[model samples]
Target: MIPLPAGRTAPRTAPVTAPATAPAGRPAPGSVPPQRTASGRPAPGAEPGRDLFVDVLRLLGMALVVLQHWSMPVLSFGDGRIATGNALAAGNMWLVTWVSQVMPLIFFAGGAAGAISFGRAARRGLPAPAWVAARLRRLVLPVVPLAAVWLPLPHLLLAMGLPEQPVLTAARLAGQLLWFLAVYVAVVALTPLLVRLDAAYGLRVPAAMAAGAVVVDLVRFAGGLEAAGYLNIAFVWPAIHQLGLRYATGRPRRPWLIALAGYGAAAALVAAGPYPGSMIGMPGAAVSNMAPPTLALLAVGAGQIGLALALRPCAMAFARLPAVSRVLAWTGPRMMTVYLWHMSALCVVTAMVVVGLGISTPEPGGPAWLAGWPHWLLLLVLALWPLLRAFSRFEMPRPAAPYTGGTVRIAVAAGLAAAGLLLFTAFGFVPGPAPLAGAGLLLSALLLGRTAGPARRNAVPAPGTRR
Candidate 1:
């Protein structure tokens, strides 16, 4: 969750850039003084100085997600067509994922970013509806294009010579990642309320949510009420999401101890508290703590937060290097784009190698697959550049007007985004009504947002672009 800074006087728009360096003279309280690097460009690390670990963790989380998708599907050509199955389906190695699950940190960062962005707007007298609208709009734009392409993709594959199974597989491969997007939108929708809860109750709120998750998991596993576990989506994420509560409350305390305690608890639960070891799912495994999050996953995230905090000072120090700062600066603004399109990039490579190149499956980790991995990575990177260039404009910070829209409209827009996100996650973008419904819902959100204040384009060029 990148806390994209909003402009105070006017409605803020997309692709927030570094504010210009202010003069050396001391600035007024509650205002940021600008700074630049040796390159004379805005030193992204300096001005308003975003937390490096947040950026680091975010980038790392996104990368791991891509890697997971990139590596998970075991693809091979058979009967002159591409076929795939999950590697995790077989091995008990999923136990490693208990410690490897990083999405907790991702959601935690999302909460903090939402808190920061909304707080900035509130200070400027920006309406709450508009603030929520602005946040949702940024989150939704990337999905529009994705749906546009994917909704029709299945039908097109069927029309082609491709078989039904492979076509459906491709469509699923494209859409499976939307679960994160869906859950994220829901958590974000609840941000303002969650922040309020923190203000009133402090740590108790997250503790309560975590406790509720424990109960849900207990019933889900004990009584075979697997459906009941879905509640953990609301429960488990908020538990981790609320860790940002400390930030929103202006209470500064050392979190390393909490992090340590979390890991200890998570390990104990996995080891002896009757929970499974893996934080992720295996295709045929009896229980998956991931698909419907469980206490094990939440504990993993809590511990991860602690680990991240314990390392922040060192991360910040390393981030200070000018080269690293510049890179972070570039990646920070485009993080959303990367998250949206990275999977698409991998899919493109899979298409080329398995379907196009007619490469057979390499015996599930046999020599041929290992030999081609470098080639696979190279192809994935090659496919990504053009996709980013074409689609990133959707993410440009558009000029926004003050939201005067009533709370009802805000709820409607959020409802649309949330519902649409859930639909997409459950069923990957599909033909006919699915795309229309999801994209249409998000599109309605944008329309409602404009009523608050119409977006007005600013003269500031999108950073790093050639005029």
Candidate 2:
């Protein structure tokens, strides 16, 4: 959820080479302020100091997500493709459980980024609808290409006489990754309201909200009322959402203190047995607090955020290096694309290994055969880089503008997408030829609408700005 800056470049970290001393009263060499634009703004490619920190955090978050997915073990596969069941054994569950809370961390960071992006757009006098449109375009655009490429691959394999279970297994796993986009879209739509909440009640409101979510979860757990626990999906996650808004506004006097409280609460809940000690333990435990996230999870997120803040100094230092900065700059723009496609890339690699290399599946809970997993993972990572490069362009944000003539076109596209989803539901459609074809049509319509440009004259860039 790192918001791509409207026009800013990544920070540079090339070391300054200068003499030890300057002539009397002269400014120290390489100490002069970076040059500014003709309009007194930092030059187009110059990174803003505050934004550098945001990018670093974003990079870290993405890395954690990648690692979590990589470490996840696959269990049973339908059609030998899509993952169907938990691969975790009792022993390994404890080790991998903490990864459950990672998504919440990602969303919290996203909420913060969204607040900043929308706040800035508002200041430029961008209308709410326009801002929403632009955000949706950036979020939704890359998904099209990913779905297009991946949806049919499994079916093609099946047609080529590949086993049914393996093909279906891979397709299902790929589809699950789309959940991020669905959740993120919902969160982004709420950004404006959350920002307003921050402006009015400050951090206290979100803190209180989080507490309430926790209480609701605890009561539900104690009473054995499963439906009640679902409330947490809305409450606890949104509470974190509001916290992100608070971070964007920069109003808290002691963020560290708030974060500590969250950590303490999380520890107490886990100890109390309201939730599992491992955030993502093996499937079929008597109590799976995470199935319906408990207060404990929220506590963990708060603690993590505090921890992130604690490392701000180190993150800033790392972000200032030129090579590191450039990589972040390049990757940040394609964050969503990478996220959506990484699992697909892994699936491709796995297929190649099993079919092309004749490798047998490793024993469920034993060491992966020959310790070859590291090599496999490395290859997957390498393959993903070039794949992402080719596809990231679809994900880049379009310049902002007003909607005009394309309203009907956009509506038709949305209608088609809705229809396709309904059809899939009724027919039990798998990710194969028909679904992929539908996706292509929907994506084409979306792209055309986005590229058609702002529909009206007032859609021009705001005075003295480049949003």
Q: Which candidate wins on lDDT? A: 1
RMSD of 2: 7.8
Give candidate 1 regions above 4 Å deviation.
1-45, 80-82, 88-92, 248-256, 361-370, 456-467
**Candidate 2 per-residue lDDT over residues 181-251, each given as its tens digit:** 54465556566666666677777777787778867776787777777886776666777777766665453
lDDT (tens digit, per residue) of candidate 1 on 215-290: 9988998878999999999899878878854543332346688677887888888788457666777666677778
Best by TM-score: 1
lDDT of 1: 0.66
Clashing residue pairs found in predicted model 1:
13-397, 14-397, 14-398, 15-397, 76-361, 404-452
TM-score of every model versus the real structure: 0.86, 0.76
Worst 10-residue lDDT window for candidate 1 reads 9-18
Against the reference, the lDDT scores of all candidates come to: 0.66, 0.59
